[model samples]
Target: MTMATVRRISECFVKPLHDLSQEAKQPIYFSPFELLFLNANYSQKGLLFAKPTPTENQDFSISTFLDDLRGSLSATLDHFYPLAARLATRKQENPPSYVVYIDPENCQGVKFVHATVDATVEDIIASKDVHILVHSFFDLNNAINHDGHTLPLLSIQVTELTDGIFIGGSVNHLLADGTSFWHFMATWSEIFRSNERDGYSISRPPIFKKWVLEGSDPIINLPYTHEEQFIERFESPKVRERFFHFSSASVAKLKARANAECNTNKISSLQAVSAFIWKCVTRVRRQPNKSETICRLVVSNRSRVNPPMTENYFGNPIQSVSATTTVEELMVHGLGWAALKLHEAIKSHDDTAVKKLVESWLRNPIVYKLSGLFHPNLVHFGSSPRFDMYGCEFGLGKALAARSGFVNKADGKMTMYPGREGGGSMDVEVCLLPVYMMELERDEEFICALESN
Candidate 1:
């Protein structure tokens, strides 16, 4: 009936009910890929919604729901024990370096926050502004942080509304990749749904073995920063984040058109959409003809690994592939031309190639200079079509909507997820400077390709 209001109630650290004894604990060595996240500046946040019970008497209460969730999370942690551990540095060497492991004393547990909002789940879902929704549902800054040797790798915020509840999980990028992170969330929901305390089981038990991928030598320590200053500058009120939905039919048409333009290759929906958006963004910027621009696509190697890491392998298993083209080439090229180049980059990194990439990084370990915030011309893709966003049903129900509370704040960032409405559709979340967004929203080509609903 009126504007919604949200307020925090309480917060506490949630630890596992059972302790991981020192003798039983093990340290999983960080592969060069996993170590990259140790100083990565971003965390992921996901919200799952629950509708009110369908009874005349409102028997359910927030306290009871939270208690159940907390217990279930603890149980899930026992299986995902590393999540509760800290990222401690090994200082005995010449320079300090990080080691990934879980020991009894180093585990600080995950932070759990309780909050309430004077809004209905439907209202929050209907709101168009992602920033408002994220701030209303989460305290983004405090969700994940690295302090000294102890890194609180994960934190969760649960918000209760008049008609429903929203669960937010924020995980450090270094601890797990998007696939592994969602796997943990799904397992937590399963444990709660089955109400299985004893003999609890998971479909895919996460493989914690890291030595196989860990190279022979560790490199010198390099200072890493999330570039907080760079992030703060663009996080001004002038920046805006907007959601652009691409219906299944719309994506099909784009793919068909792209394929038709290039007789030699057929493009994927992702490449088509990416090329389409990239052109629009570059057009909006209207950079000089002499300038060089690049598009970064994060490719996951879970399937491409030597033996193929389990779908549930728990660590960073992704690499960034970049394609650079001069402004003249990018602007003059047809969508198919751009799409073809993007497709080639994605295809080039097969399993053996990915293995070499990891080995190369191990040999000369260095922090990447580019990030989601470090450059304006660069665009980084987030999440994949297989994240199973819609199927992420907790005991309450399937989520009405789900989005990244963090990625939306950065400049030159784009995230793709499976549409909540199903039918193999996809949703794209784009963040850009206000001036560029103004141009993009007015571009007929971009506007015509997108379906608002």
Candidate 2:
């Protein structure tokens, strides 16, 4: 297979078409939950391989397609204006603070890049080194969320393939989580599909109000004296990323078996799958029975908050909840027992728990670091299978596959996406040491669970 080469065609910024100069430009303060992502960026890329219709193909042109995408994205930005805004820092403040707000007077629009790949879509999808190849599809590969002050908070790249197109988006994690990221992508696709028609309105316009815990300071102050202190970079170790598919049937069986063993129906499919992965990872690492392992799950606080923030509430309203157990307990307790531990951790993080986490962060601000989150003994689960990843159709058919960027690549980092077949299926993207990945692929128990039913 020939190595895919991505050539940059053009680069520009896309600003909102609707003017908001008259509106009050209040900065949307980042909550403690959102501030946790100050050091990371969320990057995802989707592949669309559906062939165009005969009539459409006759007149299809890459130039025209890109024009439509740009126009629709401009319209979508009218609602999600924060994406075009810059992260501003008040260095003169008592302890220094950061806020995201659009300066109508001088808006730094979202960075847009147009590129072309010199290989077929199949070459990319079937490549053994796909994880390494996908890094070229996204922009801001080396930037963190803190760089948003000088860089665009959101960067999008449209790469055309011989048989398909790849759309990749990189957004500051502090500006949006997996939910908000997909929300913007879905809305942009919807607007693009409605471009030829009239009287089209956004079904879900984002709510951009800053969510603050009652009685907590709206402005979160950092403990750093210089902006340089916020810029911490790490060169991740060599690892391999592989996708594990769990069909709906297999997932259901896992869930059923877990509930049967636990003698309770409260075990969700996510918990069951998480438990299975956690145990498999622990076993593959060959940890001692007395060693402790941790599984950190990223939980959304949108509905868990006091007032229950709307699903459209933009920005990161997520918190990480972990379930820890010794290797012996996790492996010996069986899948049901392991799942129950995850289920309890998720269920116990209620409104009060969310508030308590915020209060604790206020007293002591600690930015997330790869060293603290990702490790050999820790499995950090990010993203979600509930996101409508396959539904991001921009006049083309549904996506053929989804892949993440180079950012956040570390050992034991797993991201979950809804399977292409849908119907409760999940695609677990796992990054691990090369030796561990080789062991995981050869693990009989893990292979049987995925192939069963």
Candidate 3:
């Protein structure tokens, strides 16, 4: 476990193992969750805190600013090869492991590199100082891979512990997500505060194929008659919560009481914080005659599709959302049927109802086999002050914290973003069932006393 000099820097995309075919081979499932992986030896990496000591009065050269972002990481990986050739179902997953090798197989999704010291305790734990790749993908799965082509992922060694100054590399969360990884590190500090920007030239690249915003009717070909319906009646359920914090002026007074309970005068502060966490998870889990069926709540629809997802291709742009209940069924009918069923589920942003709900859950093969056999809990959402965490600078300054992650699924899997303060308010990380966000402020005090009427 002594590997460190990980200097492949970037641009290492591999898809041509003679471009395999036999109908484009993919189905490879060898689970047992790879016995929870763990290749050990972080060698005091501290995940991310005290190992990016770049100071010239806060201009600490996290190793020559990641060797100038790994020398413009292969022209920012040739602008994500037009989003892996428009989201390839072929063309060999559109290219990544751009030639850097030494894979030590941590599970197979390969990409791990480290180093450290301390960048002022990573600006004091903002987004837990950039989650050292969630314990290196919960102990290194398939040697860790963030799918670009073959292998290319994980490289976080942030150190600056009082000027022992060091900065490291290897990052490929498809390309970016954490608000487009601080919007490509603020477009590389606006061309590294430009002095005629050096070593990079990627002229336009981002279409990542999925038919350029697919959901008009695309899910690897989902058409089996509007699919998904295995209904075994709610099993391992538990993820029905709605937390609240409100006091940045009650989040602009609950975003004008969720746009006057969704009269749709337009809403965003993420649809009034997801209509106040979907009316406090329907008043803490709908029991009495339960089944009004309305808790989906996930939403990334990446700029409402159609040539929108640029900012360098990644994975799941998301969509589950359901929203509405007349600002929460006006607690037994009143304020105009709770603002018109919460304004027909937050103005039904229909792209053919988001492509027949992603082709009815990919033709509903029992929608994830009855949601992993009734472990149902899929109310996901992640907004994060719409990506702004003190401006994610990764050169070891800015991004004291901004959070979101995935892959721990079930027992209530959630992945909401934002809320590490100066994200300006609202924060979530939840895997919840460990409850107590103070039970969403005791049902947010009866909807802030019916919005002070």
Candidate 4:
């Protein structure tokens, strides 16, 4: 497949047009969960979409797209003020300290890039690997760093294509999780669509109190201070990222197959799809000798909290639920068995369980214990079909498609998001070792179960 040529048109830093008053400039402290992300420094995942065109533009002119986005983003920052703040490290005497501060004065501004591409959206979306399209068109990688010291946690690149435009953004994971991130995007879209100055008229405005999770005394006692010690080295055995589309009907079929003989409870679409993928990948890549393989599902805690947090509470309120089983058992058993294991893992956590887990992590300083980077037996699931990516309407129109820019997707990591033209359909992005991915692609059963893309 031939690649599109992308040329940079312009680049500049955009600061909030309005200044934050002294009362509004109070520094926000990191929670235990937020500290976990801040210490590890996860790269911001992004979503890209073709320019909207249904609604009437102020002038129906082309050149104002970038200007409008920049202006709207600047205005949006007034409500989401922390995005424009600097993460400053403060001296602390405690071990495994957590005194990182988001200083507003050093925010500076976010970087905005405008580029032109010699291709259409379909040219890239129709390809076998959509990750290539994401990498090529959305180019704000340099703006996001693994270190939390960087300011202006968000950056956007708007690429003008022959047929349409692509609006891509990169954010610092320490600043927000997937829910918080999407909330910001939706707000930006609403502001751009309505030409609003602030979020006063918006129904669900963001809540930025730093001590929202203050109920739990956040502290950690660990032997290691350097987070790198927990991360395995990234070496050879090249990895590849591939995307698979499962239509609403296809997902229903998988769910039916999973619950065919079960008398207890029926599995959900996410559980069924996750199980099928897990089984396929494990069967293709697991070694002949028996060993325990694990599947980790990322979970959000906003709705799970005792007094459920408001939809607009912004920060990293995310956790993971893992299901581990021996390779022989996982492969020998049917899809229902695998799906049951996943459902059980998810059911293990509730409001009280989540609170206890948070408190436990405060004392233990837990790090991911998965196998080394290239180990095919370890897989992690991310993003969620629940996030309505296709609903984003930025005055132009709704997003044609959506994607994630999860930098350093080592191997055996997958992200699932709601399919465009949403029904119950889903899009799963998988990164794996080339050979294993080839085996998965060749799996006749897996291919037959998917809807033609």
Candidate 5:
């Protein structure tokens, strides 16, 4: 049972690109979350401050204690490197990396919370235990939280008062996919706690070369339009990471119905949720003579699908697979029709096919650009929260709630997880269109009532 008492900054780290000037800092694949948070503070890559767990023998200033902690932590690293990588502007082979600033003048030190380890877990797990509402480690005055955005603020408060340690960081989708980032955090914990070694044994090196994913395609020569310019300039449009909660039972019932109705194709809870969203959205949006509409559903390029992307594969391996239909077609056919469309996008394993499908828009500069801008009514639903929360003990009891932030963007996407042990029920806390959430919440209530029976 080991932990520190501090508020750590995840974003403040920066790795510098050699042979590339500061002008070329941003990479072409910049998304809305990356553009905003990165721009918020380039001077300090990220922020971190910690207070020593008060000891019976002695009390010390936060600054003095942090110095002791930093020395101990830094001693184990292979070499200090910046956490921020993937600059579109810098086309280079070698680069310098950076960690959060340590200058006392750079930011304020961590403030002490009144509670001690003496309190019960339930009592200390209270939101008031951590200073989430106050000044953010990564400049809250300059930052903003939206009802929509893929990159939201996160904090891991490790209090000296108890064996528990807070574990989380606001993740902008651009930095690293869930797979890579979580692995990094978990390893960091192992090193800090083991006290046996500076870092972990048999650790794999991180690859910061994100753009290399595209390879040398002749497609780079393609032309673009002004509309595309706006999209690229604005960043990818997708769901903001606001909470969208549905009951465990409603999702299960919907999945059962979806399976029975679409016997031709097996649909998971994901497909059913997508169908539900499409019907609910199309109903309210269809004004008078609205023609065909497009809904971009983000599919995680994971092994669950055919020719799956390896769990270790990082970067934006995800692609937007579209479901297009006329207003009449969607309204008349109901969930079965939409489920069929969704089912196709997720099925079958073929790297060439997935690459081709993604490249169709990705190669087109205009579409790629506009896809980032006006992805009107974009819906994101996929597998995440990967049930990894249960493993992030850090000496604390299981987290009562675990969620990632989406920088307040638009075109809502939401992911739902298994409810309390994959019990034919689902545990959902994700971003969605508030309008749809209201309707979905009602249905969840009904499902809950039925399940209680």
Candidate 6:
């Protein structure tokens, strides 16, 4: 397949239609969870294929469609004002700190770009080099979270395809996680759809108030002298990413097998699937020098906290916990044993554990960087299958497929999304060294597990 050329047609900043100056504006400090993601950005793209409407004979005007999207996005920004706000630094304090606040007087709106791709949606999606082609659909591909001080906290790119459209979004990880990101996207679509019909009302309005951990200072300081020091950028080695689909029946079979082997029903489908991937990758990458392997699971603390945060809370509240084992033990013990290890690791990270992590980070601020987080023997699982990704629908209809940007692309990085078919199905997007990926694709045991019973 040939490379898809994305030509920029226009670009502008989209601000809220309503005046934010009428309301109180205060700087919202970052929670410990938010602080950890100061070096990363979450970028994703959703493809929407055109569907025939009742008036199929009428010509579809791209200009009209762009106008509706811009108008709805502007109105949606009224509720999610933080996305339009810029990250500010407190230099006068004893130790300089970072805060995200909406400057009503000088609001820097979110960046919006209009572009056209030379390829069709089907061609791009079906291409074997899709991992490289999808990067053009997003903005801020090189900008990290700290760049938000000067750059827009959120950037969106709408690319027109030959047969459909691609809506891509890139938000600072410090501002929101996958849950909050999709929440904003769904709301934007809701408002857009409402414009076509009747009344405009969002089901869930975002709560911008920061969540403070117990016994922790609301204002957290960073050790860096300048904001530039916070930026840690590195080009990752060439890696291939492939999507592996696990049907509901296959997942059920794996879950049952794990439970039967462990003599306990506590093993979850996620754990079982995670164990399967970990084993496959470990077997392929196992070296005599490296005997240990670790699987880091990204856990959400929204419902795990003491009083539990609402689903509408708009910020990052996630933590990563690891399940470690020697290669010998992992390989000899089999999938059930590996899954139980993951289950125990996840179970142990309760409310108390969450608090402890926050306190530890407070004492010693450690920003998560790609270099420090990844290793040859590590499998970093990010994102959740529970997020309502396919539910994001504008007037165009539900998304045909979901793709991510250049951020967080590293060997051993695995992102999970709900399969397009839903019903307990999962799509695991795996990134690995080309050699390991090739070996994984050829692994009969791993491939066999994906088949529905």
Q: Mind giving the per-residue lDDT tens digits that candidate 6 earns over 356-449?
A: 8888888988677766777778998988888898888777767777888867888898998888888888989899999999988889998998
Instruction: Kindly report which residue stretches of model 3 are placed more than 4 angstroms away from their true locations once superposed.
Output: 1-109, 122-147, 153-248, 252-254, 257-269, 272-346, 350-352, 356-400, 403-416, 421-424, 427-453
Two-way lDDT contest, 2 vs 6, winner: 2
Candidate with better TM-score, 3 vs 6:
6
Cα lDDT for residue 140, candidate 2: 91
How far is 131's C-alpha from truth in model 4 (Å)? Answer: 5.1
List the candidates ranked by TM-score, beginning with the highest: 2, 6, 4, 1, 5, 3
Q: List the residue pairs that clash in candidate 6.
A: none
User: Candidate 1, overall lDDT?
Assistant: 0.71
Show model 6 residue runs off by greater than 4 Å: 21-24, 51-59, 93-105, 129-131, 196-199
What is the C-alpha lDDT profile of model 3 across 96-176, one tens digit per residue? 111111122222322223234223333334332233333321222322222323434443333333333333333443333
The lDDT per prediction is 0.71, 0.83, 0.37, 0.72, 0.41, 0.81
Error of 3 at 427 (Å): 7.0
Full ranking by lDDT: 2, 6, 4, 1, 5, 3
RMSD of 4: 3.4
Which pairs of residues collide in candidate 2? none
Task: Provide the lowest-lDDT 10-residue window in model 5.
Answer: 97-106
Measured on C-alpha atoms, candidate 5 has an lDDT of: 0.41
Instruction: Give the CA lDDT, 0 to 100, for residue 351 in model 3.
Output: 61
Model 1 worst lDDT window (10 residues): 227-236
The sequence of per-residue lDDT tens digits that candidate 4 reaches over residues 1-453 is 366678888988777769988876877766666655543334444544555455634355457767888888888888877787777755434454435667777767777888887777787677686545567555444333335465457777777877677777777776787888888888888788887665446656888764344465433334454545554423334578778989999998888889884554569999999999998888888576488788889888878877887778888778888899889998888888999999989988788888787777766764443233235587889888898666667765667777666464767788888988678999899888888889999998889888443
In candidate 2, where is summed lDDT lowest over 10 consecutive residues?
A: 97-106
Which wins on lDDT, candidate 3 or candidate 5?
5
User: What count of clashes does model 2 give?
Assistant: 0
